[model samples]
Target: MADLPELPATITVDLDTPLKRGDDAIATLTFRRPTTVVLLDMSLIQLGLVDMDVMRDLLTRTSTVGLIGEEVDKIDGADMLQIARDVSDFFQIEEFEDLEIHIDGDIVTIPLVKPIVRGETTLDELRLRRPDSGSFRSLSLARIGQMETRSLAGLLPRISMSPLTEADTYAAEPGKQRGSLHAFLVASICTLARPGAIVDINVAPDRQQWWPGSPLIDLNPHGRTQNKKHRALVPVLPALDRWLRAEYATYIALSQQDRAGRGWLVNYHGRPIQDVDRAWDTMLTNLELPKGREWRSYLLRHSLATLARNRGATKWDLEGFMGHSDGSQTEVYAIGEFPSVVTALEGIVADMERLAPGAMHRSRTEHGLVGQLSKGDENVS
Candidate 1:
C-alpha cells in the first residue's frame, strides 16, 4: 500500500495521545494467539512504521468467508453450507428449504415468516428460539423433526428468492451505486457490537418496545439493534446516539411530510423498503473490486470480535458483547459478571464507533449525508 501515492501519506502525522494508551494496553493482548499487533486504537495515523501498516490491514479486514471455491471463485461448498445454516438459524427457519435467498441486490430474506423477515445472519437450533419461549431447539418447530442448522446444510431441499425485475434480468449490470457513508454506517454498527441482524430497524422518536422483530435485527419490541446479553444498543457510543437521533428525526419528518405518505426511514420512489436487503446489496455491488474479494457481510462482525479481543476484552466481556445466553440456567453467573463486562466493553465499543483509521475518507460533504440529515431529506442517497 505504501508503494502507491493513491494511498494517503500517514507517515507525517504524530498519533501520540491514543497511541500512549495503546502502548500501555499492549500488555492486555498478550493472551491473544499469534501475537498480532494489537492497536488499542485502530484509527488512522501515519506512524511511519512498517508494522503499523500491516496491523492496520489486519485489524480492518478479516475474512468471514473462509472457504474458497475450486473454479467459479465463490465461497466453497462447505462454507456456503455453513452460511446457509447461519442464515436459516438467524431467520428461524423450520426447514432449510424455508430460506428465500436472493441477490437482485445484496439481500437475503425469508418470506415464510410472519411479516416476511430479512436481516444479516447467525446461531444454532438450541440458539434459534427466543429465550423466554424455551432454551433450546424443540420438536414442535420441526418440519424435518428437530433438525439442526448444520445437519440440513448438506441436504436442504428448498430455498427461494424474490423474482428479479425484467430490466435487471436483461441488463448486464443493473445494480446501482451506493455512497461510502452507507458502507461506514453498516460497518461501524456491526464492528462496534454484536449484530443480531443487519436489517433495517425502526427507531421511535421517543423509543418504545415494539414486537415481532427479526432475530437478526435484535429480537425486541422497540426494535433498535441491541447487544445480545445486556440488550443495550449496538454501536454503544455517544456518537451513535447522536446519529441515531438524527436518523429518527429524518424518518419522522419524511413520514409526516410525504405527499404519498411512505413511513420508511429509508425509501425508494415513495415506497417503504419492503426488503431491507436493497441497501446491503447496493453497498456490496458498488464496491469497485474483483467479485468475491476480501470483504463479506459477516467480516465486520468477525473484525469487531477479533479486534476487541486483541485490545484486551475478556471472555465475559465477549459474551456480553456477543449476546451468548447459553450458560447455566441460573442468573448468578451473569449477574455477578455483568458490571465488569459492561465496563470492559465500553472502551472496545468506543474504538469500533470510530471508523478504522484512514480506511474511510470523508469530510462528511461528499455524499451530503449530513445535509440530508440536517434538512430531513427522505432519500439517503
Candidate 2:
C-alpha cells in the first residue's frame, strides 16, 4: 500500500507441448490479480531445459524474472530437480503427495503402494523410485548392458541379498573329503541357481550327455517334474566344466569307498559332503563379503537370470533354464529352448574376464586341492 504493487492471486504457466531440449525455447506464465491480469514472458532453455538461474528468477516475486540468460540454454536433470524441489518447498503441498521427478523416456509404472480406498483420504506407504538404467530410457536397447559390463570381482561387492534362511547356514560336517567337494559345489552353484536345477547329481545319473568337451550340460534327462526336466543342452562354460570335473573326481573317489552318500560329488579325500548350507556359507565367506553379511545361496542364479532378461531372454528361455514349473494341474513342459539364456551367460562370462582378470584361478599346490577343499570354503577365485 505504501510503495509496492499488489502481487498476483493466481499464476498459470504455458510451457511448449512435448517438452524437449534446445536453446530457443520461450515460455510465458499469466499472473492474474484483483487489479489486473499481467503476462510474464520468460526465455526457456531449449528442449524443455530448466536451470538454477531460471529457477531462482522464477522464484522471485518481481517482474525482473523475465530477463533472459546471456549464456546458452544448457539445462540438465540437476537443474530440473532443483527447480522442482524449490517449487515443492514454496508450495508446501504435503496433503497431495503426487509430486514426482524423473527424466521422461520409456516409462514404467510399478505398483509400489496401493491406496487403502478409492477416493477418500485413506493413504498407503508413500514411496518414490526411478530407474537408473534399463529399458526405462528410450535410447537404451540393452538394459542389462550395465550388468554385462561388470566383472565377477566387481559384481561380488554389489551383491546385497545374503543367505535368507537360517537352515542354509549349518549345512554339513567338516569331513576329510570336504575341500574338493566344496570346490565342486561352489563351482556348480556359481554356474546356475540351485545345484539340483542345473544337475541334481543325486537324481541324474546320465548328466554327462553333452560330451566331455562341449560347454552344454543337460542335467534333467526326461521328466515332467524334475527341474522342469528337459534336455536342451544348457550351455555351461569351461569354468563350470573345470569345477564339474573336480567334483566328479571327488565323487568317483568316494564311490571307491563304497559308502552311500547323498551328493553326487565327493571330496578329494574320498568322502561325501553331508551339508549344502555349510558348503554355501564357506564359499561365500571366501568371496570376501563384509563380515557377518548373510550370503544368499540363490544369488548366482538371480544374477544369471537378471542378466539374461536384460539381454532379452524370453520367458520360454528363462523357464527352461530356471526349470520353473507353471504349477499346472499336471506339469506341462515347454519345448526346451534356452538359446537366449546361453547367449546371455556367454556375454556375462566374457564381461567377467574383461572386468576381473584371473577371477577364477585353479592351482595345484604340494598339498594339492585336498584338505584345502575340506571345509568347503576355498578362494574359489
Candidate 3:
C-alpha cells in the first residue's frame, strides 16, 4: 500500500438546506476519515455513492458532530452524493505508468495503458485484432488510438462474444447461468431491480410517458415510485414509443404472481430482484474491459443529463427529467410537468443511438452501451 495520508482527514460541507435534529438544526456537516476498522469493513470507493444506504451508514459512523439517522436521511441528495465522492477520493492512491504496446501475429496488445481503478479492480490493458478497412467504419484513423471509454465499451463488445447474456444475468444459481440483463437494466434505466416498474404501460393517445429513470438515490425498499412527488408523465417520441410498445407486450403476458410483489416485469425465479452489484460485476467481467474502468448505473444519468443539456434542454427541463430539486419551494410542483423535457429526452436518446448503436435494443446493433456515453462517464455522482 502507498503511504497513508495524515489521520482524520475532514471535509466541511455547508448544506443548502439545514436539517433539524432534536433541538439543533445542522447547517454544516464535518466528515472525518473513517476509522481503520470502518474502512476494513466497508469498501467506500467500490460502493461509491451508487448505494445511498451504505453512504448514509458510513456518514453516521464517521461524522465528527454525530448526526442521527434522521438528519442524515434529510441531507440534500446532491450534497450527500458530493460527500460520498469526497470520502471516496481519500482511498485513491497516486499510481501511473507509461502505456505499453506490442504486436503478436494478427493481434495487437496494449498493456498498462491509462490504468483506472474501479472497485477492487484496476483495468490497465486492452488486446485487439489489428484493424482493417472495415474497422474504420464511421471512424477516422485519427480516432482509432484515441478512443474514449464509452467508445471502447461499445466497440469491444462487438469484437468479443461476452460470456454473459441478458438472460444469464438473472440466473438462479451462482455457478449456473449468468447474463448481462442486470447490467443492461441498470444501464438502461439508472435504477436497480424493479425493472419495468417505472414504465407506464397504460399509454395515452395525446401523451406517452416514456420516463424510465428514478432519483439518483434509491433507499426506498417498497419501490422508487413510493413518493408521488417523483411521479410525472413525460411525452414519448417515436423511438421511445417503439421501445415501449415492445416492452408493453411482454409486460402484459406475465401473471401478477410472477411479479414478486414488486410489479417487476423482469424477475429471477418469480422473485423480485433486490440488488445487482454481483450481476453487474459479472457483466463487467464478461466485457473483458481493462482493469480500473469503473462501471456504474450513475453514468447513465450523467450521460442523459449531459446529452440533454447539449441538445439545448433548459435547466428546469433537466431538473424535471432528472427528478432533482432546485432548492425552490415550488420545485415539487414541476416534476415531470414540463412537456419539453420529453422532447429533450427524445433528442438525447437519438444522440446516444447515433454515438453508440444498439444501445436501445438488441436487434438495432451488435454493440452495447455499458460505457458508451460521452466523457461525462467520469464519477461526478
The number of the candidate with the highest TM-score is 2
lDDT per residue (tens digit) for residues 217-276 in model 3 = 222222334453443333444443333333333333356444333223233432345455
**Number of colliding residue pairs in model 3:** 12
Give the count of colliding residue pairs in each prediction: 12, 19, 12
Q: In model 3, which regions exceed 4 Å deviation? A: 1-233, 236-244, 254-263, 288-294, 326-341, 355-357, 362-381
Distance from true location, Cα of 150 in model 2, Å: 19
| Better structure of 2 and 3 per TM-score | 2
lDDT of 2 by residue, 1-381 (tens): 012233334554443432232554535433222110111222222102434554444544322234333311333445445434534332333434453433223222222122334222332322122222321222322323322222222232222112211111222223332444344433443345464443343311334433334455655544534434332345666656555545543344444335344234324343434445565555445433333422354444665566556555677777766656443443344344467666655554444433333333233212344444443533321
lDDT of 3: 0.44
**Looking at candidate 2, what is the lDDT of residue 81?**
53
TM-score of 3: 0.36
For each candidate in turn, the TM-score is 0.34, 0.41, 0.36
- lDDT on C-alpha atoms for all candidate structures: 0.32, 0.39, 0.44
User: Which model is ahead, 1 or 2, in terms of TM-score?
Assistant: 2
